[model samples]
Target: MSDVMDYNSRLSDPASRKFETFSYLPAMDAASIKRQVEYLVKKGWNPAIEHIEPEYLMDSYWYMWKLPMFGETDVDRVLAEAKACHKANPNNHVRLVGYDNFKQSQGAAMVVYRGKTV
Candidate 1:
């Protein structure tokens, strides 16, 4: 048997460490991001945007971007809001979250933008 160990350079670097579930994967492009928003809407989950400075990512709560889009179904609108939040907070890490009303909890969450590296 060959003894080979897999080493990920990002794993050793704090700045490159994963934050959320999708963080482990490559960064998502515009079309991919839009698809995730579509999935959230299709699932009937309320979409919300949240952001925080990279240093404060470990904190439990993040600043909400406006308010949760309670009954929002338009994928464009959701993407627009997320874009706006990222534009406003260019240095902060922005994420999209899906709140499940039936389960009274968050059903999905993913980081859409990574903060600028210092």
Candidate 2:
């Protein structure tokens, strides 16, 4: 048996336009996204929005702003930030990221929020 672990990031067909944690799974809905954020908050993780502009779609690096929603209990507030980021960069690929300071790493939920069409 071949021992190979698929840990490196993956990309689906450009036509599919689906960028999710699991290549085959659909992106999480609003409710699921909220639950994830709450879970991370309860675990003492700080939330932030990151993105790669459409012009930089080929670029793997994501730009995370300095503003992070630390100690935020309201999911709406966090969602608002994500929405605002999407609104500003409507053509970009935005995502929600939670950072766990205690572990010095990111949380499990890395939600991708495809920008709105304005």
| Candidate with best lDDT | 1
lDDT (Cα, tens digit) per residue for candidate 1, span 1-118: 9998543535335485568888867889999999999998999999999999887777899999999999999999999999999999999999999999999999999999888754
Q: Compared to the true structure, candidate 2 yields what TM-score?
A: 0.72
| lDDT score for residue 103 of model 2 | 89
Q: Positional deviation of 17 in candidate 2, in angstroms?
A: 7.5
Model 2, residue 81: displacement in angstroms?
0.3
* Model 2 spans with C-alpha error above 4 angstroms: 1-13, 16-23, 54-60, 115-118
Counting clashing residue pairs in each candidate, in order, gives 0, 0
| Per-prediction TM-score to the true structure, in the order listed | 0.87, 0.72
Local accuracy of candidate 2 as per-residue lDDT tens digits, 1-118: 9998654433443334435564346667888888887887788888988887544445667888557787777888888888888778777778787888888878854645664322
**Best of the candidates, TM-score:** 1
C-alpha RMSD of each candidate structure in angstroms: 3.0, 4.7
